[model samples]
Target chain A: MRAAGRRAPALLVLVSVLLIAADHWITLTPLRAFGSGVYGSLENVTSSVTRWASDARRLETVERENARLRAEVLTGRRPTAAVAGAAAAYQVVSAHAIGFGGDQTVTLDVGTGSGVARDMTVLNGDGLVGRVVQAGPSTATVLLATAPSSSVGARLETSREVGLVTGVPDRGLLRLSLLNADAAVRVGDRVVTLGSENMRPFVPDVPVGSVVAVEGTSGALTRTALVRPFAHFSTLDLVTVVVGPGRPGDGAPQ
Target chain B: MRDPARKPAGNPAGRALLAVALVLLAPVAQVSVVNGLGLPGGGPDLVLIGVVTLGMVLRPMAATVVGFAAGLAADIAPPADHSIGRHALVLCLIGYLCALVPADSSAGQRTAAALGGTLGGALLDAALAGVLGDESWTSVLGGLPGSLAWTVAGGTLVAVALVSLLPRRRRFGGPASRAAARGHYTGGHHA
Candidate 1:
């Protein structure tokens, strides 16, 4: 028994290392799927506990969003042509944020059954949330916009200058990079997604956030800025998944 | 004749069952209650607390198995990123290292051990992931302080509670117990 005890820990360590190597090399699809299923059930139980409070909070948010949209329309800052086109082209699938994965990811209630595929853009009333990384039958894991591995192409609304927006995990802010040093970007400039090919990941003109600060002195080859994402990731309750192209015959004036 | 020191301290099957329960419960609570608490980055890792607590009580080999199981549960838990087994490797080392501390250590000492294990585990996990190119330098640097603070705070609480709650086994007619009786008989003369 004494000898066995000494060898047990070493054996466990060895097995763990091998498992890690295998997970890295191959997609453990069934295991991952089982995990997702269990996670979804737990999320449901927990979500129900906070359902009333979340509903109240969600109501406040909806009212606020309605007021903001009304103000935008009154101010003639309504959706641009590209934004309108994208909106008309994509159908939205509503989902609730059931749980979070680690520091930089969230799990949504909607998944493959709801037509949520990998790389589908997810957003809420506030703004961009993230993109779907893994889709199970009933659950989807979203890689938040502010995750360390997450990066999005964004363009300044005013100057149309483009850059890559990456997550600053520590600061909970998005860092915009690869901008020209002499670009006319300023504090409080609106940032929106530049969209991706076929709109698989991001759709054009989706509200990202506003620039908070630009790093580095002037005349550098490239500049970076901190962006305050409109989506309050930590408090996400409800979100929308951009499923796919909208109905073909429902074209409205762009 | 069996040596008392070599005998397992508790029911092996019971300990294994307890370890399995902690492994399952920790991650669920971590994602649901802890994360729901609205911490900025995320809640302190509850799974690490369970592993560290077990390490302080269980034998080295048992602790290692528990740690590996806990880490595997964490890897499969939702929101888990990077490759699986990364957490397992860190935790296995932590469990083995923590078991080296004497089980009868003072509460303060045990608390320190738990704190060290958690902080060390988090750092080692990050370092290993960074080496594998799974994590960036900035992310690791940025997250370390907050992770340390929360883990220490949580670990200290768990250590204090566990130390007080765990039953102390007294061997019948053992020298330590006899010494205590002798002290009492001498009207605290040993003092």
Candidate 2:
């Protein structure tokens, strides 16, 4: 027993190191799938239990949750004018935020099974949530816009001045750097996604955030500004994934 | 203070059950409930606390194995996008370290070990992220203060509770103690 104990920790440590190396050099798709398949259902069960626990005694604090959910229901049932306009343009699927991670990511309770392919844009009533990074069998991981490693193509909603938006994870904000050095920017100007060629990652006109502070000088290579995202990352719940372009007469719009 | 009749080691089945529960449920609870509350300072890392607690109970080798399993669960659980085994490495080391705390150590010593293990695990996790290019050092440093504070708080709370519970359970019952029933649970400590 003593001999085994002396060797086990060292052996396990070596195994862990090997696993890390293996994960870096290769994609462990099967292992990841197994993890998601097992844990995803567990997360769903936990989320449901918590939801039920909170609702079992709907009181003062619960009222706020209820109100927030009510607002969410309204948004889902009847997309606002802005969202309605955007909703008219895409085929979307609804999902719940079943889990969150410190890496500035979230697990939605929908995945490839629900047509939530990787690179699809995810959003809520307010604005862009993020893009799907991984789609497991029944769950998908989303890289939140506020993640330190995240960067999005963006532009001013009014002037159409294109820029790049990167996450300022420290302050839960986004930094927008306009392409044109001479481009005009203001504190209150609204920012939206510049989007991609195929609209796989982002769709044009999805409100990204509003500029809260302009940084650097006019003569700088590119103008940069701090943006406050419309979506509340802290309280995310019901979200939608754009699977494809809408057929112009989809039932959601009506 | 030493009870001769007590079997120094604990029940094997209970410890195995606990280790499995910690491996499975802690990550689920962490991602589903703890992270969702949007608590200030990124909240506490529940999985880390569980590892420390289990480490103090299990033998060094068993603790290491359980920690690795639990960390892997936290790593691959749907939302994790970091290098797959980052958590496994940190947690395995922590679990081993924790279980190494002498059975005769006082509550203060065990508490210190628990907090130290958690801090080391968190820093190690961030360091690995920086080293592996998963996150920049600046972002990690920026978020460290809050996460560190809360994780220490959580570790302290859990450690204290477990320390308190262990001695009482051992005293109230001999081999049948719920906590001490682990296959090879030791009983030299007195909280």
Candidate 3:
């Protein structure tokens, strides 16, 4: 028994090393999916608990926002046509924000069973949240726009100047680049998604963020600006997944 | 304090069950509550702390098994950025090394050792990530100290708790007391 005890750790370590190598050589999709399912369920439970704990504060915030929005509507400042287009064009699947993976990824309670698919866009009431990278049967993973590898086509709402918005993971900020130097880009300019073909990954005109800083001189061939995303990546709670071109049963908009 | 050389006494099955429970719950807490606590760099690695604490009390082999399972659970847990097993490999070594510490060591000493182990594991993880080209050397190195600090703080707390709660018989005194009692009886008979 003593001898066996001495050998146990070595054997287990060896097994762990081999498992690591195996994971790299092959896609452990089934295993990974299973793990995700378990974690996702646990996350769902925990998120609910946290949500319940903060219910009163959240309720007060919501009420204040609702009153502000009502005043905006009464003042004849209705939402733009682009906002309306987004609302009508995509089927929104409501989901609870479960947990974040590292700094750039988040897991959601909804998944393939709820019409979530890879590359589907995720959003909240404020703005864009992320895009789905993996969707399991009952859970999905979203790669936030703030990840180092994430990039989205964006246009300045004022000048309509198009550029690419890429994430700076270390700084927790997004940078917009490749805009024409002559473009009327300035501080506080609203940025919106340029959209993709058939709206698969990103739908057009959804609010992305605002320019916080403009980089380079005025006459350069191209310019870049730092953007602060509208959605609070750290405090995400409820979000909507844009499943497709139309509402679930509407069978794709013409 | 109990004798360090004594074989530990406890229900192996109960201990195994407890290990499983810790492995499952540690990562969930790490992801949900701990990570959300908004500590700088990230939350302390609760799973790593648990492994180290267990290592200090359990036999080397048992501790190692617990470490591997806990590490694997952490790897597969959501928000894991690197390839699976990086954490497992690090924790396994840390557990084995920690188990080698004398069981009779003071709880404070054990906790300090666990903190050191947590720091070492965090650094090893960062180094591995750098070698794998998953992250830049600068980024990995930059984040190492802060991560280490957090893990150490967390590990210290966990070690303290484990030391306080584990049965003294299971941890240090059982087998040695029995052996000593037997020796005393034989000597008296001979006298």
Candidate 4:
């Protein structure tokens, strides 16, 4: 209430400003890593208690084996053919989604320890989940495709016309801007990632979503459409992080 | 002017421990459990609410320090990509304002200030993000109405509980202010 009282708050505020200025210039990777190391472990512990035993690494493997056997006994060949076929193209590391962020991001249990790094593709059974933006020692942060900062190069699944997909966070959808002014875009057209050179952030042919609605009219400038993603962002549990292309001896099945 | 009754056993040490625990647990709980619950109206910022609640008890200096620490935790927690110290600035100012409202205030006044602090803290956060050119600021603004309603609602519960439970630091207040508190606050917070 006096001089000393007000001085402390002012001093703290100054320190915060300094920290923000410092952050603008540098990556602040070490601080983020420290945060991840401390709170990520805490999240891991509490998440284990909250979820079932199958949430554990060992039990999860056993459950996956059981599911594979159950599917083989029931249907004959691999039921998850689409996902298997997509995953076979890459050497992937499985990760559990352990945390969710307000910024439309999620924390995966895998990190640099599992060869997961920044700008790597992440996908689940349904479709594209996100891309790894930051990786700590034991955990990695993935910026969801639904984030406003996200923009992915995509192409129509059938016509193969290329476009760019950016997140419209307000609608929980993606906005695809086709390069062609007269691009033939319609509702229900499938969209997929164009894939980067060597597939750093995204791999080609990964189903992004189906066009829900086309923006603007016939022809003016670049045509745009709204896309509804296939993955249910609300209940994500398991996903795979694409580490690199499949090496020798891991070619496609005959 | 620490209240003898509230300062059990180790006095300032116990208070510091609780502050540290809150700074640590709130952010971890937010990312790991609260955010994933899929709560309606975007739920509340638990760390912000914690800062507001604790601010009502600690002195201005202590509250400011704790608020800064709590905000830093929230900013750096995994999956958070915002610039560090963005939250620290907002919550530090908020804590100071909350503590400026003397502990001898009426229950209604305390509730009003706590809710106001939460609302203001959230707004300041969005404003800073926009100013800082964080891309999500637009979408965050789109969702602000719902978030504001939920955060105020959440603030009401924590503020009331802590106000009614903790002993007020009334050592520096006049008898008339004590009388006003006695009349307005029937919960007998003067332990």
Candidate 5:
């Protein structure tokens, strides 16, 4: 009795140790099924909250624009082409910025279940954030535009000159590289995604950010523009991952 | 039930309850509170700090158990897809390292060990990912400083808080040691 009593704590500890070790082989198989359900519910709650917040902000902007447009119309003119063109350029959906994984490489609580999907793009109200790398039922990993592996085809909204936007992980900055050294691109020019057929992932004309600077090459074939992404990633509270309204050529990688 | 506040020392059942509480509570806290306070890359790993603290105070076998349980909680995170066993295995190593800290360590030493353990484990995890081709060394290294600072800060804060919360026990061979004795000994008979 004494020996058994003495050994009991050790034995219980031993058994738990074995069970924990078992976790290495199994991964999240059984637990994840349950976790997904929990996360799914949370996603609903957060999505609704974000939608309300964004709607309020949208109302503010619209009201201001309404005042401005009224002034323009009062001068005996119809809706100006510039104002109409801007409205037709893009659509916005609101999403909650939910939880993240430990390493921070992945974000969760927004996906196809909440109307997000692969190849669809996401952004903060200010500018482009990232594209959906993978979408699970109720979760997705948004490859942030600042992630090192991220690359996007971009164009200067002013000149319509094309370039590639690449991420610098360390600085949390994005760079736009133009093929022609003397391309008409300049600082403060609007940068937007260069949309290709099907809008495969990103539809054209979404504001990414403004060019912050132009860098000279030691031996460069292309000119690189420093881009300060508009999305304040550090304090991101809400975002919108664009789901399909079906652009003419959307679905595959652009 | 005997006085709930005064359970028999070394009771397997009570210990089991404690371990279970740690496992269940750790991850839930990590998800709800830790992740809710998001920084750039993500929030600090609180469960990792908790496991390291307990492991430092426990026996080798017990530390491993705590490490396993805590790591398993972490492994249940949403991104379990990209890296499954990475945390579990890494935490197991952290538990073992915790046991190696000197038993007579000062609070500062324990705090240092906890911070070191967190940073070391994070680097190991990043390196393993690099080897797996999931990420490049430069990319992982770029995020290293910020991640390390977060882990160390979180660990130190939790350690200080836990120490403050636990009732102070008189040091052995001190003036009040005899009166403060709890009548529990691992390998001795008391009359």
Candidate 6:
């Protein structure tokens, strides 16, 4: 008994080190095969619970806002066109977020199976979420809007000025750089994805986020701005992966 | 609180059954109770706590074997996306460490040992995530307190419950209070 006790600690350390090493180097096949059913069930249960929780939370917030709006309605004022348009851009599909993987990436269960597809954009109805990096049978990996590898050309919704939004990997923040010198960018200006010549996978007038800070001189060769992402990616429960309108010559996958 | 009646060392059958029960309970509880509760980042790592607690009571080799088996089971369980042996290795280390503690220690000491075992497993996870540049502080911190708390509580509960239940089910109870029965001799032993 004493002898066995002495050997236990050494064995445990060795095992732990091995497990850590393997989680990094190995592929997902065998592991998934072993636990897929269990994970699938857990995913189903958790996703439903999160959906319910978010719905409940959203209702409470709407109730408070609705009460405030009721007073305004009583005074005989209707929503202006601009206000209605802004609200429309913030609307989302509200599908359940499920199954995470990759190094800094995660797969959402919304794919072709959920009407999501390649290059289709995703968001939280607040700001940019990400684009579908890779789509599989019923899952897609989102190259998040905050990923270092991501770059989105966005324009100010109100001013129609353009800038390049880049991801700051370490801080999980998005930085907008290389804007026109005379661009009327401000701290609270709305940023939206601009249609690009190659292909506009995202819609033209979707509300991405508000500019939080601006940098560089007016005459500086390139100006930069910091945009606060609308989506709370960390605690996000549901998102909309937009299957945007088809681009030209994409009917048969030329 | 040493009992002077029966031998302190447990029989092979009793030890084997205890190991089996722990193995079965680890996965079932992890998937059902831990995940069903929705405490945090994901499911609770119940196999880790089970390995640590079992390691504290069993022989070192026995603990290692059980840990390895439990880890394999965990790796193969749902929601895991890596290889099959990752958890097996981690749990084995936790079990081994718990077993290495001196036998003369009390339950209080075992709790400390179990804590070390749990921490060792968690540290391995954090360090690996850090090296790969895949660390997410939000989910880690979000789920950590609940996971750690449940592990400690669940580990302790299983350990004590098993210890109390084993002897009673074998017909005689209360710490083997029959030295003569344990020392019973037969078949030509007419001294």
How far out, in Å, is residue B16 in model 5?
A: 5.9
Tens-digit per-residue lDDT, A1-254, candidate 3: 34555577778778777877887898666766776788767877888888899999999999998998788878968665455457666777789778776546787888777888889888887788888887877778888898776889999987888899988756667999856877777899999999988887888889988889988677887888899998888888788888877554675322
DockQ of each candidate, alpha-carbon based: 0.38, 0.45, 0.37, 0.49, 0.22, 0.19
Candidates' chain A TM-scores: 0.84, 0.87, 0.84, 0.87, 0.63, 0.64
In model 2, which residue pairs have backbone atoms overlapping below 3 Å? B10-B181, B10-B182, B10-B185, B11-B181, B11-B182, B11-B183, B12-B182, B12-B183
Using DockQ, give the best candidate's number.
4
Docking class of 2: acceptable
Model 1 chain A poorest ten-residue lDDT run: A79-88
Which stretches of model 5 miss by more than 4 angstroms?
Answer: A1-93, A101-108, A247-254, B1-43, B57-62, B72-76, B79-82, B99-112, B158-191
- lDDT per prediction? 0.77, 0.83, 0.76, 0.82, 0.62, 0.59
TM-score of 2: 0.87
lDDT of 6 by residue, A121-178 (tens): 6766466677766555445556677766678878888878777887765455678875
How far residue A210's Cα lies from its native spot in candidate 6, in Å, is 1.4
Error of 5 at B125 (Å): 2.5
Candidate 5 lDDT over B1-191, as tens digits, reads: 21111121234665566666666666655654465566665566776776676666555456666776566556554544344455566676677677556444456776778778877877877786677555668877776777777787877785575455332432423433332222222222221
The candidate scoring highest on lDDT is 2
Better of 1 and 5 by TM-score: 1
Predicted candidate 6 versus true structure: per-residue lDDT over B1-191, tens digit per residue: 12222223366677688788666556645543454444444444767766776676665677888988787766554433334565676677677667666443445665566666777776665554444454445544544565566665666665565455444543543323343423432111332
Which consecutive 10 residues in model 3 chain A have the weakest lDDT in total? A245-254
Candidate 3 segments whose C-alpha is farther than 4 A from its true place: A1-7, A53-75, A79-84, A179-184, A218-222, A247-254, B1-14, B106-109, B136-138, B162-191
Which regions in candidate 4 have their CA more than 4 angstroms from the true location?
A53-82, A248-254, B1-14, B166-191
Cα lDDT tens digits, model 5, A163-215, are 88988766767999987777876679888888656665776776778888888
Once superposed on the true structure, which residue ranges of model 1 sit more than 4 Å away at CA? A52-88, A178-181, A216-218, A248-254, B1-17, B100-102, B105-109, B167-191
